[model samples]
Target: MSKKNNKIYLDFAATTPVDREVLKVMMPYFSEKFGNASSTHSFGQEAIAAVDKARETIAQCFNCDFSEIIFTGSATEANNLAILGIVKNVQKFHIISTKIEHESVLEPLKELEKSGHEITYLTVDKTGLIKIADLEKAIKDNTILISVIYANNEIGTIQPIKEIGKLLEKINKKRKEGGLSKIYLHTDAVQAINYLECRPDWLKIDLLTFSGHKIYGPKGIGGLYIRKNSPLSPIIFGGGQEFGLRSGTENVASIVGLAKAVESAFNNKVKNFKKVSDLRNQMLADIIKHSGESAKLNGSPKSCLPNILSIRFSGLSNETLIVALDRAGVAVSAGAACSSRALAVSHVLIAIGLTPKQVKESIRISLGKDITAREIKMATEIINKTIQNLL
Candidate 1:
């Protein structure tokens, strides 16, 4: 716990250490290009140009038109705006979301519930995948929106989003025949953006959300991709920035850094994919080989994200293991960083049918671009040894 023993950071899913190149790009903007983008002066015009360029870069990364991406304070804000914005103009007071959504999506849905809107929390399979059949059955006459995460944050399982999109499209076509308005589909791609293949337009995603910090960029800057002509309302009222969908002055430095970080991530995606996946499997193999039958993985090995490994130790609480690992110079997350303090069982695990005991025993270990295979072996050895001693 001391400064000298902070340990190797292995919790990339929670957040990554800023990439050095990204920091280099962000440094000059803090003072040199520091101008309110709304001003009419030359400095302001330069800032505006920088922000516009960043927006175009982000759109290109997502394979969407420049006008569709609305930068926000974070993906949390983007989720709020995407979900709440669509619901604001709707007479139908119903929404559908998964139980595994981050607090950002869940909190806004709760607020809508408080306003007397009906929201269905869908269940996922053991692999943390939502069944399309279940989704179809959950659809109601008043259901106006369906917001599912593209990939889970804790277990890192990628959802069947393309299939879900096709289903929604079918529903929309039927609605058109019935002379009824179609339900909108939104996906929180916050965890999926940099790690996997993501083409929002091809996936038929109406609104997609992701964060800058999650992808090794500056914090306090993220975005929502809104398909053109979508019904939405701005939650924040201000100087009509981001085409009046999101209000306020832009975080120019962070925006520029985010665009650059995203570009870097995409450029390294294929190489990182094989490297991280190999590291992830090696870590899992080590844990299983060393920890014996007590070790249990929470999600499907093949379907989960390449960078994340969620494992549970029988008779070991995550808090205990976290402290043990921290003392041994390894850093791993207990669960979603946001809910670690509440000591609640991860909603993600619970939704996937993990028992309460399994939930408490679980920890999420996410690898970064910089983590080496040797480091992974050491981390797993520490985990296995610590669990043996503790048990």
Candidate 2:
């Protein structure tokens, strides 16, 4: 729990404060070392070198070639690039994604539908896990891409990406034998990158997208890993930067900060995973102890990311609880921060079979690496007490 002037931030899924080390390394590039990476002069050369190093760092972290990693403005942009980029200029095709995907992926898929592309929106079980059989059945001959969220942002239920990837690999081999176009597998790993296996071989994915801010890096920078031969066209065309796939002047400072943050987080993944999960488990137990029958935890605990908890308190309002918690100096959310502004119930919760009334009763409490046990204890008390007061 990080409290400044009595405020505890529990919304790590939305974004994270930039790590101190990442900030330290980014300082020079913002001032003395600033330069346009596209320029041909020494300043530009220096800036481009930093960019290359950042790319190399990401490649090493995700176990991909340097050329396969493409930096973007945000994970939203990366998701757009991976989804729209692959099927660009094609006559017609099909794609598959989950009902629980972030708007970044869902919106693009929706747009593709307007352009005559077929999309299959797979449903999830009560625990928010997609069925592999459903996905296997959704494949059409022209199905070129399948984009799934590696871990849902709201409920934090991790989809079986490895199983899906292996299924694709086998299907692709037979498709090759049959002379059909390859069906690329893309996972929006923005939420899963911090706590899951991301190696391309391990997941058997053709494309993976993640955000910098989600892992304690600065905002405005994200990364995409494209397999060596994936056919992706540029959605943003300008100066032909980023190996001609994403064209724009590189954001040197955020790029370096992203790399440093990713390297640090990826290296400390096991330790951080255990610590955050332990804190979250303890907090869950405490919250459940108090709320008991009134509280219902929304997703599979075993399959979740350990940091995120979506819970509903019977007969209480999420909006009211959110206000009460905020007044008490604890920050939380009703659902994905991206969709928090909307009045409608979360599409994610609905897909998992939550009623509109239950959706209004639910709130999300996500933990960060900086959170301490004391903070969790305080937060648990505050949350339960707030519900009692509301009741």
Top lDDT: which candidate number?
2
Tens-digit lDDT string for candidate 2 (87-194): 886778999999999999999999989887899999999999999999999999989999999999999999999999989989999999999999999999998878
- How does residue 356 of candidate 1 score in lDDT? 90
Q: TM-scores of all models?
A: 0.97, 0.99
Scored against the true structure, residue 330 in model 1 reaches a CA lDDT of 85
lDDT values for all models:
0.87, 0.92
List the pairs of residues colliding in candidate 1.
none
- Candidate 2 Cα lDDT to native: 0.92
Q: Write the per-residue lDDT of candidate 1 for residues 182-296, one digit (tens) a residue.
A: 7888999888876777778677879999888988898899889998888889999999999998889889999999999888887888888889899899889888888789888
Could you tell me which residue pairs clash in candidate 2?
1-371, 1-372
Residue 308 of model 2: what lDDT? Answer: 96
